[model samples]
Target: MGKSGSAGPLMTLDINRFNGVPLHLQISEALRKAVSNGQLQGGERLPSTRSLAGDWSVSRNTVLQVFETLISEGYLEARVGDGTYVKRQVLGDFTATSATDERPLETKASYPFRGLSQRGKALIAHRLGGLTERPTLFMPDVPDLQAFPIRSWLRLMNEVSGRLKGDILVNVSNAGYEPLRDAIAQHLRTARGMMVESRQVIITTGSQQSLDLLARLLVDRGDPVWLEEPGYVGARAALMANGCSVLPIPTDEEGINIDLGRSKFPTPRMVLVSPSRHYPLGGTLSAERREELLDLSRTTGAWILEDDYDCEFRYRGQPFAALQSVDRDGRVVSIGTFSKTLLPSFRLGFVVVPIDLADDFAKARAVIDRHAPIMEQMVLAEFMHRGLYSAHIRRMRSLYAERQAAMLQLLDETLSYTPPEFECAGGMHFVLPFKEGVDDTAVAHELWKDRIVSRPLSMYFSGRRKCSGLLLGFAAFRAEDILAAGKHLAGLGDLIRRND
Candidate 1:
């Protein structure tokens, strides 16, 4: 009863221009659906490509490509003289009545195998806080990507790329590029006051990988590991992923409570601390606590992981010498990353292990990823060797200090109350504590809706006593943007009032 060839059925395609799908693919899919649904009957001829293009407001070539694709897929056939037609074989036993009458078989969705392992589930449970790939306003620990020295970096990259030859390409070191290790060791000796040797330094993808590698290599499964309370979530995730039992040790203005940890979780296999400047809180570990921590490690035979992230960005006075610098024994494994000082995407970080563990760590590094990219290492080595890396750090320190000052001034003028911790000497972010009854997570969620990114302080805690607050980052934001976002933040005045 239908016409042998018709364009009427193809006209109601419901093409969407705003859904980000390609026009040709959309047209092809619509045609296939029409044939499958029996809306277009078997052996029904389609309109000419030009006619379809004009009707759909698409190019003639788009329609032609769509026809060719469907023909190849056997959904449609093309004749020399006649126009395109739906393949009758494709509709075998698929009559117009059957297409409408036959329903899809009723079946529940089922997976082929068992679900994730317990370790996988634990890793998911301890996952780090949400962070957008592209940095947003007030996103903590993100550096100013726009301010990176791309010109100098690209020049170094070009220089390195040109030098890549037989041995450079084929004979990669398991430890890392040697010159880069030399540069890092030299920098640590001068800048961080750590007496590290190039042979002891092993390059990793980043600090996250460094933590994971150390966790798996240093500790056995179910070994107790002491972590700073309200500590780095990534560290917690890494340790838990390796089946380590995380023991949260409370911290104060001075740093991790050494006495409290010894009294409670006494026999930890390892102790991880951000001693240079405690993350989020900006508290420097006291000299006494550092000694105590080292003593604790010595007596207990536990390894100490010093996460010296963002140590180079200290705004005022000198940061304390690295914990590794004071380690009498080689029990301290210091991890450093360019993610904070340089670009996070560089994926370059290193660990200064004890002399005995260097070869073992290098072997593990080889097993994991066979070392970081060669060209990047060469470029970074050149950059550091030329003193450009230190120069960049100095520039970023001044810029971040100005931004921090601007943010503090904004908060002071806007908010009803300001916490004492807001006057921190250095660090990328400041924690704004909320009253006991206030839900910091809910407040953070509401701020996100207003295009202001913040991490709820409660999310950082693995222990029972969780503090409710928000970590507001200023390092990556310009003064004007910080002011603009601060206005929105000020609107939540009562919501962020201090508990005291």
Candidate 2:
């Protein structure tokens, strides 16, 4: 009932296209369909499992499994050393099914996800993009992987594996390790001028976790949270996910316009500030505005989140004083990250919260993720204790400073590009402001084809075109690379201005 390999035909499988399915599964299903459909005739010599695997861009074992499944289903047979072949009875099952259409499975038409608890479905059903690739940078938010101290980290990891003991292995300290929290507190006091105690510091996996914890700690559903317009989109996503209404505070050269933000929200329950060097535009909140914002928080009894995102890379003389330094009302949650300064894999960050809210935040953290890993906490604590962490910051501080200068210098060399309407004070990125009538997004698409990703400032805006610019980053770029990136920007300028 079936033809042989001598049927003189062949079928090929494609694997490069992104079907958005696992590669191996895609391969297996493709082969199964061919065999069941008789397109791959019976008794045909199949490609060597290894050969098929090569075509599929997958491993040989995966192909082997596919072959094995077909054999088990009587659709294929192995002839040992020579090769595998399709079974002669391959068409037998087809005739049995072709006589009449098989009834669809009598499974209940009820919800397939009924078994999942309501919370489970809700958790998975929730959607947020750009978390995996926030800021939409060409380089991405990760560290230069080649530069990670793998040997040192592995040594620390080995030490952890060897010394893991009863309480260390089994106990989950929801408050994070004491050494790590203390170390963060010490670092903040010395470097940031934020007077915080060890108990006031809550270790987090990353800035994201810190944001989520704060949202839960401070915001009730439908409460108002004010953030800089065209600000850190990640923070906006976190607040929105927690059911808070995010009010965008317009940012000027002096950072967020404090009085206007207060007027808009009138009674914002919480305010998020990136005072040292504001995001996207990279402008610092002027001292007057910082004080004014803190005063607003104090008067209104609203909470303040001082997101000191990358203050360590302040390219100038002295760093700005943190808002927490002037926060006598115990209202500020000072968030800082190692992801920017030392490395990204560290996933180590801390939130300096008020003493009264520390316990509650800890409880919320427990519900969220229990706590960050003790081993990482221990290694990072040791790194800081050895002064290595500070040493790295001092080194990278200068490195990013030079990179920033280089990006600016290269921009000056090209005449094609227009000067950005908005400028950064001292941060990793600067927004190139665009005119109101221009289609900034179309320009962004043209740049993508050139492999240069600059974020349109308006993409960060939630309302009408309150601000328009492009956010370029140098946080993870070397000084030389910064020059090239600027040239790329210049080339883009040539293409864009040519239209004019």
lDDT, candidate 2, 208-305, per-residue tens: 88888888778898998898886777788778777788898888778899889877678899988888877766677888898898888878888988
The alpha-carbon lDDT assigned to residue 274 of candidate 2 equals 86
* lDDT, candidates in the order shown: 0.85, 0.72
lDDT of 1: 0.85
lDDT measured at residue 118 in model 1 versus the true structure, 0 to 100:
79
Q: How close is candidate 2 to the true structure, as a TM-score?
A: 0.73
Model 1: per-residue Cα lDDT over 414-491, one tens digit each: 885554652367888888877676788788778888788888888899978888888888889999888777677876
Query: What clash count does candidate 2 reach?
Result: 0
Best by lDDT: 1
True-structure RMSD for candidate 1:
10.7
**lDDT (Cα) of model 2:** 0.72
